[model samples]
Structure formats: structure tokens, C-alpha cells
Target: MSSAYDMIPVLSCENIDKEYVTERTWNGKTKTIFKAVENISLYINEGETLGIVGESGSGKSTIGDILGNLKSQTRGKVFYRGQDVAEMDEESFRKYRKNVQFIFQDPKGSMNPYYSVLEIIGEPLKMLGITDDEEVIERKVLGIMDKVGLSKSVLNKRPDSLSGGQCQRVAIARALVVRPEIIICDEPVSALDVSVQAQILNLLKDLQEEMDIAYLFISHDIGVVNYISNRIVVMNKGHIVEMGRANVVFANPKDEYTRKLVECSFVN
Candidate 1:
């Protein structure tokens, strides 16, 4: 019998690897390669949250970047709706970029400090050729801002002028403006306060429910991952140590690394 993992996912990667050249010998011919992610395979189902958890250097962010097409993997194929992303035509590639939006760990950093919330959120639509009309841009921006719980009054405020929580809400609004099929959230709530984190997480959940958007949620906090994910992927030293239903992995961890993570998260 086939399992949920057998189904073709909204976004999926097979045996992907990412390597970075960290050092070079005096001779240009000799160099040291660092493997940031190794032989990793994962998937995100339609309207589902697939949480990836690992420590700071465990390659979680690298995987996110690769999947979002912000960075390329050194090996393997990434599929969108079962089509190889690398082989896509120009029009198809454009569609992929438009449909796979990203939310970064530092909300304010990802945004242009000089631009107002309206401009920041509306820019993606124009960039993706969705629209260039000012009226349409403003209307869509305001609609998404309202959905993300941002007040209209802050529409003209820049990222520097907003509070951390408000900045994150704007970041989310920007991502949602495109009506993406998937959002790659790379430690999106890590920079906020604990209270703000909960609010942002809840907002993401509500938005996912309403928009039917999938998420590849990457973070170091196992607790946070558990709260938002239907399934979990745990990485260690550039490898996926374990992956399964969130509850099952959290309740009865099978791998040593996974057990350590669960214990650290739940032990008093």
C-alpha cells in the first residue's frame, strides 16, 4: 500500500545536495567543499505545513533557499506538481517564482527600509507581472494587509517606523499578496518576542486555512515546529535524521538525534 509520502506533492525534492567552497589551497586547483545539505528528500502537500527543524548549522535554511529557487542545489531535482523545475521553460519558471513566495527570519531585513508598507507589499505583484496599475496594487495591498491583521493607518509607514510584530505582519502581507501556492518560511518568528511569535504563528495558521497555501516551515525550535506542522522533518549535520507525522515523532522519537530534540523541547 502506498503512503501519504508516495503522493506527488505540491512541492517536492529528491536526493538534493548543496555544497559550498569554504577554502582553497594556494593552488587554484585545490579547494575544500563544505556540504551544507546532503542527500535530502522532502515534500509539502497541498494546504499542509511541513516543518523542518534543526540546530543553527544543520542546513535547514539551505534547503529552504534551494526549494524557493533563491539558491541552487549542487545535485538532484526539485519538482513542482511533479514537473522538474530545472527543465521548465521561461514562462513556466516565471510561474514557479510567482507561486513560491518566501518569508524570512528577519522581517525588517527582508523589506526595503525606505519603502512604505503599501509599496513593499505591492511590489511583488508588479515584479511578477500580476499588475502595474496603482489603483489595483493599492487595493490588493490593503486587502492582504487587512487579512494579515495590519491596520490601514500603517500603510504609509516604513519598516524602520514599525514595531517588530507589525513589521512581521507586513512581511506576511507581502508574501500573501501574490496568492502563492506555497510559502517558504525560514525561521520567520525567531526574531520576535515569545508573545509576538505566537501571534505570528497563529496568523500564519489562519492564513493557510483561508488561502489553502502550503508551507515549508524551517526553524530550530522543535516546540514551535510541533505547534504549526502536520508533519515534521528533523535534520542533523546536513542530513535528515528522522521524519514522520508530527505527533508521532514528538511523542515517540525513534532516532537518537530526534530523541534528543524531543527531550530538549518537552523536558521540564
Candidate 2:
């Protein structure tokens, strides 16, 4: 629609497709190809929480992986601040990796069981050679833990000792520790209970406002997406079936596939 580069979105996906090929032995003569994502495209405005919704196989997480540069795409373009991600070199890509971080669905799995909360959060900083003073690292870690509702006491505890919500909070603190410009949340709250989900969502809102960070939130729950997202992107079969404002898309879906997803999520 708009061709002006100045008006370009903070993150835009153009014609993304991802596939995996594996050898199959039906008659020792064929192989199987699984296309996880088909030519999908979408855009996210600056500081906006763009929600990608669909069923489990709809390529939502794959899209996040592609945007975060965690996985290479078979085809497509991902523009971060108007520059194509596919063309980035090691130095440039490392910088891009810092700008775009991810929060996985299971914080327990994402975190190290052997590392303490403080160590887990500080690992990235250490890897980046930021090497701050002990006091400075403690101060920053505690401050971020406070921001995410994690207690300083748990800083010494292992992830296995903490509750699910607390572990997820630690993961959030780790993501925020980097002060990333964009965060790709892959089902960040789906594992928590409804009350905990609300708490996490509130934390995200507060942090987003305070830090001016953009979010690419991926979830299958339309109600949750409706509550947190400014705009919604409906995806199916590796394609962007529809896109619009969250309220409008949920209320008036233009695609049958999108409508079916909404119906299933809200029907109960």
C-alpha cells in the first residue's frame, strides 16, 4: 500500500516460506517434504504488540523463529527497521540478534538447571563482554527482577526449585536484561494459569510502556491475543490469511480459515 520507506514498519515479513525435507522409505524411491510456512507476509508498527494467531500447525512460531533469525528461511524477506535480515553478515547479524531476542514458552526449559537466576540473567551480558562490576551486575539483575515481579531471594535458587510462573518471570527478566528493541514471545503465558497469565500480561504492558519495546506475541488463544494485541495477523497453512486491527479482525473476519480459528478459541 504505502511505498514510503519512512513509513515502513519496524518489522515486516514478505513472502516467507520454510520447508523441511526428509528421506522416506516407502519403496526406497521417494522423500517427504514438509512445508512449515508458505508465502506469508505481515507488518508490525513501532512499539506495537503484533499478535500472530492460528492453530498449532499454522506456522506462528516458525514465523517468529524466522524473524528472530533463529532459523533460516527457504524463501522470503524480513525487514528489521527497513533492512533485510537475510543479507546480514556475522557482525551485523550479531548486532541484529541483540536487537531481536526471544522468550520461549517454557522458561524452565529455556533456563539452565545448573545456573542460578543471577547467573542465568548475566550469561548474555558476560558473553557480550559487558563485564560490569559485581555490584553493578547485582544491581541491574535485582532491578530487572523487580520489574518482572521476581524476588531477589530467588536469585540463588535453581529453576527447578521455583514455580512455573516464577521461572517464566526469570526468563522475562533475562530477555529484558539485554534491553532488546524487539521481543518475539512464543506462547509466553499459555503454560500458566489464567490468573498468572493476567499478571504476566500486565508486566509485559508495564515494561513495554517503560522501555518502548516492540513485541511479536505468538499465541493460539484469541481471547488472550485480543486482550494484549493492537493488531492481529491470522495465519493458516503457512500463509497470512488475513490481517487487521485486533478488535476488527476478531469481530469481522474476512477469511473462513481465520473465522474458524476465532470460533474455536471463543466458542467455549
Candidate 3:
């Protein structure tokens, strides 16, 4: 018999393609089509971290946004628990939204400056109809904040007043408040100091072990991905050029682009 981990994918993408149409004046006014993503397909198992790495403009973030339901793909299908997400009814989609959360690159900008830390973390709970009771919401928010290494003293403060790492903690706390099954982290630690990045990555690893949550971690840094990911997928100009176990890909990169990425990661 197989364990729950092997039963079904937490998230799946099939032949996903994304394109942007722009009007340009190259010769005269003409329409230009840019392929942000093309024929990309991957999946995340329960409690697994699938890391996507590439240089800037490689469509890593676009893939993250599509997976998180922040944007729609131009073609192909996204499935949650073997069910097509686009075909989900409103009620099912709402539940899917709660189960899939996002952690953005710019921690400070992702949050509202005017909202208190408590409010920022608790807002998702309220939006999901988890609870309307202020006391219960605060209790849950405080609990998650503690788990994310935040102090109660910062609860009443706005995100602007907190350090970069602290702001990211709040974001993590917010994502955890929903008890999400999958989180799409888009360069979640790139903006923070090197020391702080390690802390956040460690926290994510710990949480994954404890909660059995799956992560779609997107970043330009192969080293960071190698530290946290079980499997790694390398993207180039929207195409998946190389993918394999983190160690295997890092040790013996098969593609030229992947080799270059590995080289640059070590150099930097």
C-alpha cells in the first residue's frame, strides 16, 4: 500500500503556457506576442518542496502567479487534488483559495502599511469565514505569530515600523493562519539580509516537517533552492530546461543553461 504522500499531487500543471500581447512601433504600430511561459508542466507531492530556479525574466514568477491562482494561463490546465481548478464552482474555488496561499518577494510591499500586525495576520482568517469573533481571531493570529518567531509586542505595530525580517514573519504568519496545504513563495527571502534569509528558510523547512505542507518555491538563486527543495526545476525563457533531485541537478547539470545557473550561483 502507498502512503497519503503518494496518493495524489497537491498541485499539478499540464502544458501550461502564458503569453502577453503588446503593441509596438518597431516598423509601424504592430502587435507583438511575448511568450512568458511555454509548455511547462510539474507537480508537487504532499509535504514536498518543488523549487523553480532561473534568472530574471525566466518566467519563474509567472509560473508562481499561475499556480497561486493570481493569474490565469493562456493555455493548459491547473489541478488541485486531481480536480481541474478552472472547472471548480464558486464554493470549491473559495475553498481552494483558502488552501493555496502566497508569499511574495517584497515582504514590506505585500502587506498593508496601515494595518496592524494582528490585522494583517488575522485578515485571511476572517476572509475565509473561519471566524468572526475578534477574540478567537486574535488568539489564532497570536498563536501563528509565535510559531513564526514573532513577539507579541509587535502585534500592535504596522509593517512599516518593523524590520524586513519581521515583516516577512508577519507574512508567513498570515499564510499559516489559514492552515494552507500549499504555499507559492515567490522569492520570499530575496529582499532580506543574508542572515535573515537563512532564518526564514529554516523556518519554512521546520513548518513543512511539522505541518506536512507543500511549497512551490520560486527563486533566481539555485543555492537557496537546493537548501530547501526536494526536487528542483530549472526554467529558461519560460521553458523547463532541466529538472531532477536537488543534489543530482546541482552535481551534474545536463543542460547548458542549468550549468551556467549553477556556476553563477556558486560565483555569487
Candidate 4:
């Protein structure tokens, strides 16, 4: 087991930039350029949770998409285990895709209402070519279900039958089924109630400890970020203004926007 001081960075984003361009009708012809992420750089260490907090349109979710290799970066490089993600060929990227997974903010968005929990959780594994060993796959699936506090009894049920929290657990189990080294959680707990949020947060923290997985947790709630993050990165308009230990950044915010965010934080 590695201690806090022995943290190893697994993902590095250097001078990362992205923009969206579209053609519009302005005087019969026009063009628009919208910047989604601007020079955002941060490193996520192995077995550590790095929480990113920013309001809406602050490029929090875009960072998750970029790092998960779901979306390409227009400029700069995203290094996963010191290899440029942009440079990965289809064959090499297949392996990299296995090492990284994403947990979206909306539980329903991640799951399919028409599919049973088993299918939803097992589909990704199947797509990644987990076959010829049915018994082993069942064991792995059940093990992950147990890890997320999900019971086998609910495995046959459709997503609609489960509560929101249970649905989130199923989503989490789905992500864990792939045995990814890192999980990019795009505000996984924000949509749940406070009590349920704590349960999920504890579940994630425990899982990170047990599985040796790193997390890039994105959220707007500083309180939630502080409750779960090892490090905090404050973003504003696609730029990271502050990055440091969670406690240190919360206790002493250097950026005025961060201070305003702290002022708006839940004091209760």
C-alpha cells in the first residue's frame, strides 16, 4: 500500500486546449468559434481523488470527456501513463480505453431503462471481449455488485425498478466491471440527496482505497468536493485558477472567484 507521500501521477494534461467552430447565418454567411477548454493542465495521481469544482459552463464536464478519450483535444496533449492519448492508434487505444472509465453525473443517463441490471453492467465487459469463461464473468460481476453494496436479488430487475441511489450504485458497478485503473466521475453524487450523497461518497472513497483506482471527480459543490477529494482544482471559464491539497485550498483560497465560491458554499 502506498502512503500519501508516495502518490504516483497516472494522467497528465499539459497546456490542453479545445474549441468548437460552427457556421452560422450572419448577413447570409458567418462563423462562430466557441472555446470549451482553454489551457487546462492538471495531473491525477494513482489511488488519489482529485476534485474539480466550478460552476456550469466552467469546462468541468469537458475535461472528463477529454481525459476519458471520449472526445479529442484540438490542441495540446493528454498523457495517460506518460503516453499521448492523441497519438494512440485504434489497437493501442483499445488497451487505454480499458484503463479509463467514466461515471456520468446522471445515473439514468448511464443506464438503460429497457435493459436489466445484468445486461447494463455486463454489456461493457462483453464489448471489451470478455467471453469463453461464463462462470468467471459471473463471479467478476457478482463481486463488483457486492463491492457497490448491490445485491444479486436486484440484478434481474430493470433500472426503473431501483431507487435513484440504487441506480447510481448499478452505474458504479457497471464502471467497475471493466477493472479500470481510473474513473472520471463527472459529479457522481450531485443528483442525489444529502444522506444518499454521503453514502455514495463513502462508497467511492472506499472503492478507491480497495481497488487502487484514481478519480477525477468534477463538481460545483465545494462542500462535497472537500468531503471526498484529496486534491482540489478550482476552474473558471475553462481555466484552472487554483490547484492544491483540498484542505489547504479550502482554508486559504487565493483566487477571488474561488473566494466568492467559498462564500456561496454551504456553511451549515
lDDT (tens digit, per residue) of candidate 3 on 1-268? 5785668898999999998877677776657889999999999888889999998999999998998888999999999989899999988888899999999899899898899999999999889898999999999988998899999999999988999999998999999999999999999999999999999999999999999899999988778999899999999998999999999998899999999877776644
Clashing pairs in 4: none
User: On residues 1-268, what C-alpha lDDT tens digit does candidate 1 reach at each position?
Assistant: 4577677788999999999998888886538899999999988988999999999999999999999888999999999989899999999899999899999999988998889899999999999999999999999999999999999999999899999999999988888999999999999999999999999999999999999999999999888999899999999999999999999998899999988877777543
Give one digit per residue, the lDDT tens place, for model 2 in 18-92: 988767777775488899999888887768899999889889999999988888899889988778887877776
Ranking by TM-score: 1, 3, 4, 2
CA lDDT of each prediction against the hidden true structure: 0.92, 0.87, 0.92, 0.87
Model 3 residue runs over 4 Å out of place are 1-6, 24-30
* Candidate with the larger TM-score of 2 and 3: 3
Give the per-residue lDDT digits (tens) of candidate 4, residues 88-207: 888768878888888888898778789988888888888888563767777788889999999899978998889889989998998899989899999899899989999999999899
Clashes of each: 0, 0, 0, 0
What's the lDDT of the predicted structure labeled candidate 4?
Answer: 0.87
CA lDDT for candidate 2: 0.87
Give the lDDT ranking, best first.
1, 3, 4, 2
Tell me, by lDDT, which candidate is best.
1
